[model samples]
Target: MDTRDLGCGYDFEVENSGHVFEVKGLSGDNGGVLFTDKEWSIASEKQEDYHLVLVKECFSNDPVVEVYSNSHRKFNPKKQITTVINVNWSISTSDLNYTEIN
Candidate 1:
């Protein structure tokens, strides 16, 4: 994975898959995720290869993580452009994909 570490929204890139992932987290209360317009645009361009990794209660040891693979499709269920700079997405608990991480 590669860190962006500067301007241009989105966090890291997964080498070789042409897949880039934006990390998002909730406290089990906030209940949703947000992406910047630029970030979503980038993901949109990448289509089914982009990803969103959301963690519930991120500070906890047993946090619940949901991987939105091919986020363009997964996010389609609740994707909405909030403004010129932000895009809001609602994620259903049932839509989560769990990938085993070693």
Candidate 2:
């Protein structure tokens, strides 16, 4: 996975699926911050400097996956910074062919 600057924030793209994800910085102190939405919600209060990834699984179902790291922080006095998270997903399945006679 690779990340690119998108002015507002950063864009994450998956290598295999080519799926893209975005991460934006919220205004205010980086404490007790919770990413809430109708689909999924991710809270990163414990990890002070972190990015929240909210993914919507279905119309009524969604899951928030948290990717923690120490790479996120405030570089300027204003304390405004955005971090991008890249995730590589891989799946493998095996099938067996069999014949039976009764």
Candidate 3:
């Protein structure tokens, strides 16, 4: 669902739970994903139920997935472009629900 095209505002929109996901894939050595100002603007408007899914250690055969739910509306992690995303509240990984990919 991650697209190279710009201005789509997000990666995927799930129909079932009506949730949205902005996915980023990175190898463990690179650290966490970065959310741009444009992306943040979109997320701010659609914070109803959105998520940021970072698939870390992507180069490794077994990647680790970390989904930060409603992270858009939650934190104000400065205006810096390179900061790691932060969620102000607690959301269990299981609770950061997403649609199944075939």
lDDT per residue for candidate 1 within 1-102, as digits (tens), equals 557676556688767868777899887735867776787787778877778888888887789878777776666545575546777997666555554446
Can you give the lDDT of residue 12 in candidate 1? 86
Cα lDDT tens digits for candidate 2, 1-84: 446543323246455653344454433323233222310211222234334343333233343344433223321122334687
Question: Lowest-scoring 10 consecutive residues by lDDT in candidate 3?
Answer: 1-10
The deviation in Å at residue 52 for candidate 1 is 0.6
User: In terms of TM-score, which candidate is strongest?
Assistant: 1
Task: Give one digit per residue, the lDDT tens place, for model 3 in 1-102.
Answer: 444375666788776676778888987846645687777877787786778888888889888888887777676667764558876977777766664556
Model 3 accuracy (lDDT, Cα): 0.74
Clash count (model 1, backbone only): 0
Which 10-residue window of candidate 1 scores lowest in summed lDDT?
93-102
User: What residue runs in model 1 are displaced by over 4 Å at the alpha carbon?
Assistant: 77-102
Cα distance off (Å), candidate 1, residue 8: 3.6
Per-residue lDDT of 38 in model 1: 81
True lDDT of residue 102, candidate 2: 43
